[model samples]
Target chain A: MTTDGSWRHTAPERGDAVTISVDGEPVRACTGETVAAAMLAAGAAFERDRSGAPRAPLCNMGTCFECAATVDGRLLTRTCLIPAREGMVIKTPGRL
Target chain B: MFDLAIIGAGPAGMSAALTAADHGLTVVVIDEQQRAGGQIFRQPPETFAGSVLHPTAGYGWATELIRRFEADPRLTTEFGWSAIGVLHDDAEPDGLCVAINHPEHGTRMIGARRLLIATGAYDLPVAFPGWTLPGVMTAGGVQTLVKAQKIAPVGDVVLAGAHPLLLLVADLLIRDGVPVREVAFAQSIPTPVDMLRALGAVPGHLRMLTETGAILARLVRKRVRVSSRTIVTAARGTEHVSRIELARVDRRWKVTGAPREVAASHLVLGYGFSASTELARQIGCELVFDSPRGGWVVAHDERLQTSVPGVFVAGEPTGVAGADQSRAEGTLAGLGIAASLGRAVPAAAFAEAERGIHASTRFSAVVQSIFEPVRGALGDLATRETTVCRCELVTRGELDDFLESSPFVSNVNAVKLSCRTGMGPCQGRYCENSVGAILASAREQTIGLGGRFSAHLPIKPVPVGDLRDLDAVTEQPASDGSDTGRSAS
Candidate 1:
């Protein structure tokens, strides 16, 4: 996704970057980007509900838990609240 | 224990912290976000170097206050923490105790002589067909993503609903190069006379007037279709938003035509906002229901103190007036706290703060009158097939069936029990009000009866592992008698 270049932000110069794994695939994002933003940027889907239907973030704020995913073996981790970190493993409903 | 402890580091909490510190009061504030500015002055990640080109809604004053609040040594802010439980019993006698938890840090009990719950508001969610799709979001939520993260959807975007945030966010999206197709409003276009009247009532805030005019002028020049009496009938898509449906409404907001479909990858809805009053209600501070003025807000006295003495409330928790009102109330609350602490208050500063409150009130009234949602607007939006409770996956049809079979189902809490509507991780923040509206239509009970559920301990979804260490915390038993108004939604 980052290779597509300027798909999201037109500004060519991004700040320092971090690498994290989303749905078992390595994704590069801005250093301080949230897991949800990184996932959305990488065109990845988040957790599935009890019905197994994919849920996207309705409220990017932490209050809405729609974007909850498993990060580093911690289940129910809100993607919007936690910042992206190096080598963090994120598990989502849809495979990328 | 500090002299003052505040929840939410938004405009109100940050302002209160600054005023308290200036008056020689020790202050500490906690916010769920990682920064001091709440939604209005949402600051990007400190590490992100990108800059936003435009400022909206008190950007200047809020920016200055947030900077001072962060740099002031006397004021301390604990970010990424939420108050889980509140205890104000005989144990501390000094003040109330707030139990907080973090995803990384386990749990800690903070005690303060005086407490302020300035927890802000969230986008009011109204369910409709295809609303659960991935591309649909609250307008403010998208604003945060665009304003803070500098990310925008690459495909077609549509902004719909009855809120000023829609206009502002639509303008922001266009500036960010997001292809926004249309700006739809459920309310009729505010006539020139209406705008003039509202503006005339609050003539001093010329900056706000000019800024709004400039945004509107730019939007008009861009040829972005801004239509009134339009409502989002449905979003048509499977997993992500592929298209959206728009319909025309009459003065009473009744659907008068078939929905017109348009291809869209993003849908931003801003129907209204509900105050995050979980902690306020949990502590038994009196709450009243005024739909436009932040539903189920804390009932405070002239000094901004909640029903519980030594516990003060300001900002959106008291009502959903924007940042301006919040700062005024925050300052007044700080002054009240300093006075209680036996500090000499500056008479001139106190008068100016009061004047600010009155001016904000005037502006708030105008904004409310313009952006208020008509009852008929939402009455016909969600269908029986729509998903009302996003957390529990309860559809309107399923809820209606439960209500039909179950005897004496009344109030939002009753609906929650009937089908586990509000039992999930969200704890009814998304579905409570929508379900309450359904109940009101069904004649079950009033829309809001002390929120979707009673204010319970551990208001947030604390990781199960963290609760194991809760055995050592003290418990305070407080009565709900403090709440004077509790019936209406």
Candidate 2:
């Protein structure tokens, strides 16, 4: 199992995985995985702080930008379209 | 120009331009792209070098109209010119002189009696973490890159997200030899009862189903798995995309404990789009909000007249519609604008336009219902950290606080004033609906006059540089609109 205690190393054919932190929790994700997909694997659904409404990945890709979170101190990073890195720290904007 | 100056040469704008010009009105159609067809009916670069569209139905008709319009001596089609601004002329009533950045020729100002804007819409991409990574792209952008550019998005791609357009895109990808690992269809399929109800919308429903079915068939041929009721929870990988986690949702759409992950190299995401209309607002068109139709839209009558006289609209800019509807409405709106300008539209033409518009609207309503932005599916509402507008860097809490403090409670304009949410480069295409939905939910009231949201103008963002020097643009470019319509009809 990887960090954040969600994803585990599967098999050799599954390909190489990478590690990143979501809202301060460390998680390991696969290579080429979008930040949103990795977060979902790590059980991180609510990517942003809720402003009196629940916020999840709306467009799931780029058009919505709803899944934007702080990555390595940069705000408004789209997790769905962004690929994961080995040591990137993601901040959950509007985290409860 | 005698009357209206349209900014685009695509279906929406061309429809209006041809219609307006036929009414003994001088019209100038300006576009940034080398030719018409926008992105929807985009053809190969070589084909557009001089080839035009055909006049037959089945998509070929668009080429035909272009050919006929090019032949119209009264009309001036400025291909490859960008509209800089709708310069507000103080002297003219409902008059706006447009500054254009003509491609080869310098800038020029064209005065108009009125403007018929059909700026059209763009994809609305919701930014997720890591979305800026290289492999991710909007479904439309991906399709354009592949179909128009002949470039593959990636080797093994995961085509995910909702919207009927995505299905078509996935099919296109497979056909293009792009390896699609799996399709994570976000919007759940209609329930059996819902499907049956949708059946009443036979033509519309059939259209959507057929498109989806085509994608499915293509995927099946390529042996790609199609997963429904599944939401991509997270994406993982190294320098590129590698794996995606899928969560199975219950009947209530609650993600179950069971989580599954798949591997892929690239991710294509596009939920859909709202009416992109920022230019219309700059010209002072009235707006109405209808949640079912996405965010704000321009106010136009059955004749497609805006609050400003002589201006008209058609196609997705009015709201999202399929290609056939857009073409139909485009044709009708052209006729309507012509009639409004005193060019008598034959009774048959009016009827035909009405029928096309009606059918498109019906389908649009169904699309709205199917893609409804449900509340709880988002996330915790109390957090102040989540971003609502990625481009503006406006946080969710900031807008909420502004809404609570401002007098324009629950109105997006007021909120925009307080937080600059909708004032970003992409305008409000991405976050308007979420904001509208939030406002409606917060006030516990329906949007607009009758459970609808307010529609605003210029539904999209006009380029700043395009407006820098408007006086140098050319007044005329294409001596005549030509119809060499050779791209796929």
Candidate 3:
């Protein structure tokens, strides 16, 4: 869509890179990093609802429970805590 | 009588006393603590000996300020005295009177030409499941144990929740050689790129992160493991905490299927901080709700002046920044007071104190990134049998029924009337946030967004007997006076 993976700014390294999907579109991120980090690097806002409401990571570890998104067909995974694994299928729960 | 009377011996209060005395203002500093230092800078009793040492002592800057105040002949320090109420004596010009409850001496009214309210804040009480357990405590409580009491709370501690203080306590525990079974770092929320874009103003952000990193590393070094994205759902114990149920939350923070159980003797939960402005509220200071700071804060300006003239707020009560910022703010407030009194302070002095405001901006943003009020989590506290008011042994069932059935129980005041939840000795510090959260969570269902609770006074429980014979009593009209002007509950 844009570099930064989303069109914001391009990343310089790829060692942490792992592959996941954003609204069915494939994206790459680093290993052991959070989905929020991946999404931010990709320049995605991490909003999951179809309402187009803007959502970003609040409370980066987990307490706020705000950075949730579907991971590997699982509903509402805390992107801030889930480690990036290669070939992980992500779904925007609004679609299901 | 001292030329200046300062309330609340926390960092702000102590610094004000020290600064004013140095500037030749005869000063008296009063505090509720048996010793000096507020909650953030709380130090242990002088008698305890241990292998552990704090990297920085309690009220590091306040301690330095107090030392200066002690040497100044113009200052008198009063410890263990709680300010009962402030009475404005209309009969005497520029004269304000305060009734202080001294533990041994009893209540006494002191008059001062100039009053500086450095009275610091208290923790916003947020209740949780099994939060009433003896072994379960606020992060500030745990820090008091490690830093002030030098006692290990338990053999194995499962430290959970969000907030910088949470990480700091975990670090202190690790440094003290206490075994932390699991550092469940569950304070994550979705970060917007826009949020991080404002990071330039805060220099303390990296330091807080570094402190957290160091604690994480120390835990690892001590053979303790890190478990991020997890929360302790239930703490199980007979007399004390013996087991905890850990659950995984996805992005929206809903628990996934099946939780894992961990056995431990202690469980510490710290969500974040609340403005400890009960004293401010008691004196009729209006409160403003700032989402980032948790709970109600006394509305102040760029210079730390409050809505009431001659009153100032600094440190955590202003908002939850760290020690350095508190010290800077305390000094800035002191200088402002001095300047207001027509005393000259060099322009450079003001600029120097301002560095912390800039430094704390980044830190506040980062801290804000980590820990925010767990919006709907308190709804989980509403199990029918769950204890809402542990002090009064009131249950969630009782409160709900009161809200639904009792015609008089329409709002928080009415709820207080029907149930003794906020009427206990610890006051509402343990229940108000939970009560508000339960209401907000329920409202979110139909209203689309959860409503918030407004803070009130006497924010702390004042013994009714303490109010008699206090001459400076002034009464405001019967208005809610909260940021929302009404309680959503």
Cα lDDT listed for each candidate: 0.78, 0.59, 0.58
TM-score of chain B of 2: 0.80
lDDT of 3 by residue, B83-168 (tens): 65666667666666666764234455666556666655444444555555545655765665455444444367787775556667
TM-score per candidate? 0.92, 0.70, 0.72
Q: Model 2: runs farther than 4 Å from truth? A: A1-96, B47-60, B66-74, B101-107, B197-211, B235-243, B250-259, B375-387, B395-409, B417-420, B438-489
Per-candidate iRMSD: 3.4, 13.5, 21.4
Error of 3 at B43 (Å): 2.3
- What tens digits encode model 1's per-residue C-alpha lDDT throughout B1-489? 677888989888988988888887777788878777888778787776656434564456776787788787666567887788788646667677778777767676666788988898999888888888888899888888877777777788889998878878988887877777899988787889888878666665677767777877877888878889999989887677889999999986778999999888888999878888888878888888887785678899988989988889988888898888888899999998888788899788788888989988898888877776664358457788888888878898988788778657776787787788778888888877777777776764455542456677788777788777565454222122111121111
**DockQ for every prediction shown:** 0.46, 0.03, 0.01
After superposition, candidate 3 runs with Cα above 4 Å error = A1-96, B1-3, B49-63, B121-124, B189-208, B346-348, B406-411, B445-489
Docking model 3 quality class: incorrect
Task: Identify the superior model by lDDT, candidate 1 or candidate 2.
Answer: 1
Candidate 2 residue B473 C-alpha distance from true site, Å: 10
Q: Which ten residues in a row have the lowest lDDT in candidate 2 chain B?
A: B480-489
lDDT of 3 at B484: 16
- The DockQ value obtained for model 3 is 0.01
Q: What tens-digit string does per-residue lDDT give for candidate 2 at A1-96?
A: 232212221122222567888767778765545566556545564453333333445344233455667777655545654556688888875643
lDDT of 2 by residue, B1-489 (tens): 345677666677767666666555667776655556666765334422222222212355667666666577666666655454566666666566776553224355666656667666666544334443335567776664444333344357776665666677777777666667887766667778767666666674464566566667777878888877666655565444567666776644456767687766567775666665666666667877654564567778887777876667666667666566666766777777677666777998789778977876676676678875443343222136546675566766776677677644766666666677766534666666556555665666665521222233222233244344554432322334331111111
DockQ of 1: 0.46
Best by lDDT: 1
